[model samples]
Target: MLAVPLLGLINQYLGFLAMIAAIVLVWKDSPWQKGAKVAATIAAMALLGAVLPDPPEEGAAGVARKDRKAAAARTLTSPSPSAAQDDPSPTTEPRPEAADYRGMRLDEARDKAEAAGFGTSDHNASDDDKNIWMRSNWTVCFQKSSWTGSETKTIDFGAVQTGAPCPSTDGGAIPWPTMPELTWKTWKTARNEVVALGVVPTEHLRADTAYLNDTLPDEGKYDNWRVCATDPLEGADVTINTWVTLELTHPDNGCPDPSQSKEDRVDLPDRDDDGDPDYHDPFPGDRNRNSVFPNGLPDSSGNSSGGDGSDGDSWNCPRTRWC
Candidate 1:
């Protein structure tokens, strides 16, 4: 009785206290304690071999801890929904292609070329002397590049012809005042080219002189007739609606004998009497020749073609047509 009283009162008995605790727990005789108390009690019971306390089963608490860890990992690695939506998608620009403008009217060709992202440059045109016939009656005969090629700066036009594809060439052609390169072209070809560029050509038949490239052929048989010279000359800028004389003769077919007087042959009028023609002479109608050259002579030789019989070389004046 004394032992029981002592044990119950003091609560210091050490004989398998786990059994007593478990019993106390089962009976609900002990007051409610902290979780540490439950844990300690479980360990004590395990030591004493009183049906070792089972480990905690994977329930909501364990599952919840695992879920929290997985969420943290995902936050560190994956992109957010808002960020993905804010990004923009990539795109590309379209390329331009070439278009064919051959056989079309000048105005129509220009418009079409512009629509296709290309520009037009008139290879041979007299913009200052633009005429009705040139604008409305001409068609593109040749081009620098094929219609199907890539886009470029200028589309060159070789020749203009008026026929089925184009309107009438009547009322004459344009009279542009720009200089054109007209070398080695026949008389008909040269006239068409220069007139197309806005200048009218005045033809001079050289009956006395022999001509090369068969100048002055009759009509459509112009294959043998070629141009030898031009008045404003081949490369001089002239006024629109002005005259540009072309010197034409057949050098191969018929040429006058050189032994005959060259002085008698039709020469351009030179009032200054210098060797150069009046049209080309810088200082015309000056007798002394001192106005053009330092001493009115081409060189120090002082060679002037005067028949006074001085027995010295004649003076060739720099800017005189003929003396």
Candidate 2:
């Protein structure tokens, strides 16, 4: 009981009552009775303090605590009638001017931004389809907004989840190859198909490549693992080497059905005259130029073998002019 003398910090009244009871019960005792009576006197003095006009309490340890509490009460319970109008606690905290949403996942971040009671806007964090919000697997990697959270915001989310920043603005959309059924196809073979479709083979595929010269036991040199799945599933308009997810697995999963005609529905012909044909060229619709801009001339044997003039010569290749 002596060890916990300060336990009544939570309620001084209860402490005083306990001290009084102890004094009465030990009234006839010797040393204990004397100590109880002394404690009872202190408790009674404390009770008197709660009712009387409080003093500018002294700085001694006990007096200081009482003074601090009394001052706090006085500050809150003004003698003037205006205490009812004075608020003790602040109602709200200052919100951020522009919430830093970078690295934040979209589902939760969107609600946070909206709840700020500000005008809001959302944009594809990445033009790359894989970074879509509804997919519930993307995050905000970039954002633009006014000084206030209450203004229009333009945000974009993307590959940051893959531990990279926003998409590179370095390249533009090109004519993409029809997405081949990549599932169960050897990565080496699938890689070739991507290249043939006019993809740079390096950007997207390079990132996924894992050289397991030591293919899993019994898996031959040819067993460099097959692609379990391909993103931009078959025929989705894709940038040649944009972010494509090649979900790969062991070759034992099975090989691609080579039986599907390599020619079936393969739009290999150049409907347009600019060297890159419909399948490999972005502007297969335009007859005079190959891309969004001109100068995309036809080439042969990996060499630029077209006319130097402004108009393309669809007529003049000496060898097989493979676009």
The number of the candidate with the highest lDDT is 2
Collision count for each candidate, in order: 19, 6
Instruction: Residues 1-323, candidate 2: write the lDDT tens digits.
Output: 22123324445565556555555555645356577667765665565445444445455768878889999999877655565467464677553565777667766666777776545555554444443446244456656545445544443323233223455441222234467777667767777777666544455653131221112223244446667556666778655435565544444333234344323322224666444445435556665445433534444443332334333453343464322
lDDT of 1 by residue, 110-195 (tens): 67766666666544332224443564555664455433345344555433533322213322244335656654466667677766
Weakest lDDT window of 10 consecutive positions for candidate 1: 205-214
The worst-scoring run of ten residues by lDDT in candidate 2 lies at 207-216
Top TM-score model: 1
lDDT of 1: 0.49
